[model samples]
Target: MLHAFLAAAIPNPGPEAPPGLGDLTNTILAWIKWGCLVSGVAGLMICGGMMILGRRNRNQLAIEGVSSTVWVFGGLALVATAAGLVSVVV
Candidate 1:
């Protein structure tokens, strides 16, 4: 019968699926951590290079570079704190 065929074709999902939002939250947090790490490293490298170049040229650009580096570090710290908060809350 059509009813029997349809029922047989549907696969049963036992314990394979996630129980709730925990798995999703952890996965998202992991992605955010990696993204922030990579970007932070790249930003630091670029700013460091700029700082070195500015110093060599004896120009005011070095100050700007330092400020930019500070901002990058601050942003990284904020992201890290946010991720930790999410883990604790969720």
Candidate 2:
């Protein structure tokens, strides 16, 4: 009886099976990946501008710009690796 229940609960993923929830999840993840990439590029541009503007002043704006740039890149890397991370966990 337990084996029958388990088999019923986990259906085999074959070609005949219609699209599953995993398909929707993959679509959403793809959109999120693109969004992250665009945002990271925008952040880099803004930070570069800040760094340039700070060059003429005696403030620490350049340092802030560098830190923000690093954070944006890190976020991009995380988003890019999400698939591999999910695979590892699951």
Give the number of the best model, judged by TM-score: 2
lDDT of 2 by residue, 1-90 (tens): 999999999977643325687788778878888888999889999999889877867358877887788888888889888878876775
Which 10-residue window in model 2 sums to the lowest lDDT?
Answer: 12-21
lDDT of 1 by residue, 1-90 (tens): 999999999986543435787789788879988999899999999888878989966667777878899889998998879846765665
TM-score of each model, paired residue for residue: 0.63, 0.69
Model 1 TM-score, all chains together: 0.63
Off by over 4 Å in 2: 1-22
Best by lDDT: 1
**Model 2 TM:** 0.69
Candidate RMSDs in Å, in order, are: 10.8, 5.5
Evaluate all candidate structures by whole-model CA lDDT and list the values in order.
0.83, 0.82
lDDT of 1 at 69: 92
Off by over 4 Å in 1: 1-18, 83-90
